[model samples]
Target: MSEPGSDHDAPQAGREPIFMLPPVVTALAGIMLAIHLATTLVLDNVGLYQLTLWFGFIPMRLLAPDQLPGGFWPLLWTPFSHAFLHANWEHVIFNTLWLAIFATPVARRYGALPTLVIFLVTSAAGALAFAATTLPNVQVLIGASGGVAGLTGAAMRFIFQPVMVGTDPDTGQRVLLGRHLASLREVFTNPRSRNFSLIWIVLNAAVPLVPALIGQDIQIAWQAHLGGFVIGLLLPPLFERSWQHE
Candidate 1:
């Protein structure tokens, strides 16, 4: 039988083991950060504005295909393209850090291909939520935060699962078998994990509310975050069987 965590079936010989980041996720985050920085520096406000107009996914405005130049492709691609645009350095930096931290573990757990699929699916869901809730005339919805939020939600699912324990037949020693949802619930219900989850929820829920409380026009896109998180939370059980088979 193959080792549980082994990447391939090759014999454990003299060859150096491959040590590499998950390719699809690393590439996606790197490319997004690069584009955000490059565009911020290269384009003037007017140019940047125009770029956002063309590439950003604004659900309400996007409903009218005739308003945009490229039409259907823009709508399809916008789900990904919006992830490359940002309001400013602070926005990109925060989102990039979050993506790097949360997504790496998920990519490692699920492998690069499944990670990418989850990201795209959750991102599209986030965008659709944003479009559905807001006014139709809103010009552009930009940033990778939605996708990152999805990754966060997915991470929560991956982390919060049950574990199996058994006893050795001969030695009569306890052994941890594997993790599953029941074990996760036990962990989460404990004070530490429950506190952490509460803190996370409070902070994210406050993100949009704080801006509004300050009487600022800046929108935090909380709806997208919530949408992505819910989708990710629900997706794990559906995908779990296949993931275990892999």
Candidate 2:
């Protein structure tokens, strides 16, 4: 039987096995960082403002689609496009770092095309979830947090298993997916998985309250994080066939 992540699980009988970041994963992270720099450093305040207005996911627009500036057509792109933009250097940097960790495994297992698909779908799902919970004219949601959260969810599919030095009966050596991959029950029952889930939930749950303690009026898109994470957790199984061959 084929195991998930088998493609990257073991090295072939080659001269040497070199470990490195897959090119596509690196490229995706590079593109996000490059865009952040270009928008923050190169673009003028007015230019950057305009881009945000155009690209940012505004829940109000969904309520009043006819009132959107530059026509309602921009709505078509904003859902996924907003992920490519960030509010500040810290926001972009943090998300990019997470992407490197989670997306690398996915890209290695499923290839570049599927990784891109995951980014788009999770980004949009997160935005939609944010819109669903928020009232109109609240605030615009920006950043790759949702997409990265989705990646985190995807990684949870098999990354938490016990590791082995050599081939073990339960899980082979260096195999993240393990012998049979994890069922939802195995995932939730595992201590590491349970703790991570709790921590993630608490962190997102506290997003709105955290800003208040600092006397800031920021609206954190916690809804998006939850949405993306749920999608990530559930999406991997459906796409299992794509990576099973690896």
Per-residue lDDT over 123-219 for candidate 1, one digit per residue giving the tens place of the 0 to 100 score: 8887887877786556467877777777777777646555668897999999875456323465467565466556766776777677568887666
- Candidate 2 per-residue lDDT over residues 26-79, each given as its tens digit: 887788899998887888989987898899988888677666676667779999
Each candidate: how many clashes?
8, 1
Candidate 2: worst-modelled 10 consecutive residues by lDDT: 10-19
Candidate 2, residue 1: the lDDT equals 55
lDDT by candidate, in order shown: 0.72, 0.80
Best by TM-score: 2
> How far does residue 222 in candidate 1 sit from its true spot (Å)?
0.9
